[model samples]
Target: MPALDKIRWENYARNLAKGMTQADAYEDAGFTRSKQAASALANNPVILQRVEELRTERERILSGPTVFDEDADTDNGEPLVEVTMEWVIERLAANVVSAQSTGNHSAANKALEMLGHHLGLSFSDKKAPSGDEGKPGSNLGSGNTFNILSLTEGLKQHAAALEQMPMKDVTPEDDG
Candidate 1:
């Protein structure tokens, strides 16, 4: 293929990696807008390989640990740490305690809300209908009703389980 065509193909693959639709990527790569041509190129083995490479590279770049620094200059400050899900949860938990100690019920509730969400608790505005309603021996109550003590215990158990699990290392070098 010509050098310009190769460049266009690379651009098309890059665009695909960036989550563009095949037709959109083709047009964005300077190719005339044609669904048939886009489909054909998408199916090409060389283009497919290139697209896969670009996607893998993108994933590697995105999967790196995130570092949050309050100051732009990192020469003389606290050591940088990788911000993981556990780290975020710890921060939220701390915020909840801090807010509660300061008599900020609103802030404490907000922190607890965020912590609940992070812990996979579903907070739906609408309550789901419990099919057991109207059945014999069924304790009929609001569908959204839950035992706060049990829920809190369950969350504690879940947090303990998560703590026991090993964290996965996702560095690019580990791919090999």
Candidate 2:
């Protein structure tokens, strides 16, 4: 039941800038008044704007420029699209964390949506796992997800792409 308050989001993004996982950010925020922190931060519009600015900037640096619209056709003040690698890395690693306490599909979906928005792209979880076994899910060998296996050709097409990725950026889990 973690609530996203302005201060908490700012703090979380700050920690993320320091390479902390989202789960750790949830538990490790230095909140002197945890109960009222959300309300307090919400009242300060400046802080909220700052949070969005910083987060969006970091998100831009995480993903490649091809994802953005070079034309900037419609709005003069429109910001560039950004794809933060933090969420993807966390989701991918969560698969190996047996005792993981903080993770959810909703959060994962939001991350992917945010990334797509930054890329001016749209992607559905066509391979998202289901209880029914027959339904197709992301298979590493089959190359369903836009992950390492699928990106191999693209990586070879452009050698520079492999160098720009964020730390520990890898393929996410099949279920997410």
Candidate 3:
């Protein structure tokens, strides 16, 4: 039960890191909230520590491994390299241009194919239907209206409301 309580506290902390209010995190973790009890809980030294720990862990996970070069060149001049998507794409493009200039048709074709695949212009998971078969409302594909911007705006509004709401009591039955 103590372990379970700690897990709940961690969950609340994670939620709080995602911009939820203290009261919202408290209620979200299935804990009952009194008039000022939520504030008291949020201020608890142990809970605060856990919250910081959770936030730090989340940051670490999101950041992944660092891209660093031990042989990095400064003004002294040495080998320097950066491994990034943009850098890789630019190198590929340069290779294609060089191949073309040198009349290396095979190398140019390979580089172009690689670039096209990376940019999702080639190699689809499913074979696209031919002619009218690919059209929306056809037997091959369904016509579904999707407005991503509208959906994102709706979610932001809902999240704002959730953040503003005060904590509420969580019954034992509901918690289970």
What TM-score would every model get versus the actual structure?
Answer: 0.36, 0.24, 0.34
* Candidate 1 residue pairs that clash: none
lDDT, candidate 3, 90-170, per-residue tens: 556655656776799999767766765565443323433566555553442222123223433533454455457443433
Worst 10 residues of 3 by lDDT: 140-149
lDDT of 1: 0.65
Q: RMSD per prediction, one decimal?
A: 15.3, 17.0, 22.6
- State each model's CA lDDT, in order: 0.65, 0.45, 0.56
Ranking by TM-score: 1, 3, 2
Residue 58 lDDT (model 3) = 52
lDDT of 2: 0.45
lDDT of 1 at 23: 95
Clash count for candidate 3 is 0
- The top-ranked prediction according to TM-score is 1
Clash tally, candidates in order: 0, 1, 0
